[model samples]
Target: MLSALLHVTLPLALCVLLTRCRLFDAVAVDLSYDHYAEQRVEHLPAFLAMPCNCLVNLLYIITGVYWLLRGTDNAEPEQGRYLRQVFAFMSIFYAPVQWTRLAVLQRAPAVLDQWVTLPIFAWVLVWIGFIERGAAGWRVWHAAVLELLSVLSYGLALLHERGFEVALGCHVLLAVYKGVRVQLTHGDARTLRNFMFAVLSCCGFVVLKLLDLPLARYRIFQRFTGHFWSKVCDVTQIHFSICFLTNMTSRTKKTR
Candidate 1:
């Protein structure tokens, strides 16, 4: 548990510290209020500037906590717990970072927001690794090495204006590929349904965020906003991921 907490937080702390040092000053991020479709309520405090945006993040905390408690109770192998909980912890840790980004609209939080996303998606890959290779065949160092590469992938952001986007694209692609591959290897009809839902949610998560502004032309999006729905998609993906991974990580359960 302590190791999982460290794995989730240490990177955050390092990113925050580096951001404080202006390491991502050159990074391209929308640091403007106009970046989001949700209008800031002038009467509210900065933290509540965009009520929907700030409040939407609560779903992450809720999803993360809910899934963290779902360990393999009497399962034969127990190693999947670390990967599952690490990913859960990452989700819980993510809420505040994203909320801070919308609230303060500062560089550190903005950079941290984008930086943390790399590992969050990477953890999915890690979880899939455990699903493919059971406990005994997987080692702690294997997770460490992959996650270390994920953490380092954030360096791509400093290279070009669109570097972060490029890195994020790769992470999303690899996760999707691994997910599809695992379905063929270990998934049955039930897992396939869960995987499809997860992929749809993942697509919504990306597309809605990208269309945040354009979607504002619609009345439904003016208040709720595309960003808000994107978060809904985010939490939805997490939920399905938990369901899918929980099943796959179970050693006693038979897969087709």
Candidate 2:
């Protein structure tokens, strides 16, 4: 019953907020559209693009919160400690990366080519933290596989022009594997919640990519739908993260 409610209500609520708030308008402008000669702003219709990007950014923030919470909860104390350390390290490393984004937001090629690697690098550190904290057995193996895949995806992105395609595929696989692993290992309501959250997160990204497709002739509807869907994704991430943190902090008392 709880699952059903979350599944139905959460997405609906996000959609409502996104459409009503004009989020898409804000983001499209912020993302910088002056780079591509062919990607002229005339086609975007500022009214639509602004809200679309806004909603997408909102989703990103929400997902960050969700993962932090969820990951913390499900994490063992030892694991939690290491995660914090890794997060701190990544945060420091990423500071410069973000500065680079601000400094070169106008430089599209640099942003996509160089700046985007920061998060990938951070995740590598996270995987190492997991290993150090005793995320052994199959979990360790799984993390190693993901790390390798992530590195390869980045490399492919750098080497080939079709990096986004490869990266997206890898993201999907990673999401699926993590979701299944959590559900199988935990076998609790929280695990189910995490799975749902993971699905929503992936869907959010997928929808964003779809919105960018050239098929849309009218910008208004496209922007509206894109923004709305993006928010739904963001909320799911936050919910999942919180659930993760809760699970980690409060374990079932051991039986005598």
Pick the lDDT winner: 1
Provide TM-scores for the models: 0.95, 0.51
Please write out the lDDT profile of model 1 over residues 1-256, one tens digit for every residue: 7788898788788778888986678888888899999998999999899999999899999998987876466552556677778878988999999999998888889988998899888888888887777765677777788888987898898998889999999999998899889888877788788889999999999999999999999999999999999999999998898778777777323431
Where model 1 places Cα greater than 4 Å from the true spot, the runs are: 251-256
Candidate 1 lDDT at 203 equals 96
lDDT of each: 0.85, 0.42
Residue 139, candidate 1: C-alpha displacement in angstroms: 1.0
What lDDT is reached at residue 108 by model 1? 85
Give the least accurate 10-residue stretch of model 2, judged by summed lDDT.
247-256
